[model samples]
Target: MKKAAMTIALLIAVVATAGIVTGGFSYDPAAAQAAARIKVYSAEMRNYFMSDEIVKSKEEWRKILTQEQYHVLREKGTERAFTGKYATTHDHGIYRCAGCGLDLFRSEDKFESGTGWPSFTQPIAKENVKTEVDRSFFST
Candidate 1:
């Protein structure tokens, strides 16, 4: 059964990679692969997607970040409990700051805190990690 499942998964992967369209949904291999690979282990590139210390005006940031992103990363807004896409994700890769692409957390350090938040016990780098008191509506 395992072998058969693996074979089916392999076939699906090939079909998806070939950019198949099924039931009004089109598969983009490049985009799918890119999304899957966003979890980086270490920084190896000089300039990727954006440069380090990306300083932009509020207007520019409003133009760049999505509504949810602008609210969360910019205003330090918190999503409702159990509503974030990554809250329960268990992927093995780096968790980067959506606003600055700063490497934040590692997959191995993720744990279920019963608070419906993505909690990490270990940050990959101390230099990149800083803590500030969250004085938001949900600050504890």
Candidate 2:
């Protein structure tokens, strides 16, 4: 478990640096109050997962999530562009994971990427998210 956590932490750090490029947009790190918000959300996110890690069976997830969510999250399916609820939202708040309710990104980190999906500059904290290399369709 420790090793896994360390590996995830390292991956998260790498993802943080890659966040802007991955989304094809950038946010101003010098934006007013950005640092304070980051600190607040980072603590909130850390506290959120202070308890046991979440582990749910597919059957359980199906019961908890909508069919669409199950398709996108569990089956690794994609939603049609611009169809997500937060895709065009301009509200200010932290964005939580649909599957586990983990606080993942802040509204401040989000930018207008025109990709029809909500794009964030970074997670609230590197530790709050996980990353993996996608080696699909002849790309890494």
- Per-residue CA lDDT of model 2 for 100-137, tens digit only, reads 77678889999989999989999887766777766675
TM-score of each: 0.59, 0.61
Writing each residue's lDDT as its tens digit, candidate 1 over 1-140 gives 99999999999998886665453366688866655443323444522342234568999989978998999878778788888988999989888887777877879999999999899897776655667875665767
- The lDDT, on a scale of 0 to 1, for candidate 2 is 0.76
The whole-model lDDT of each prediction reads: 0.74, 0.76
Q: Enumerate clash totals for all models, in the order shown.
A: 0, 0
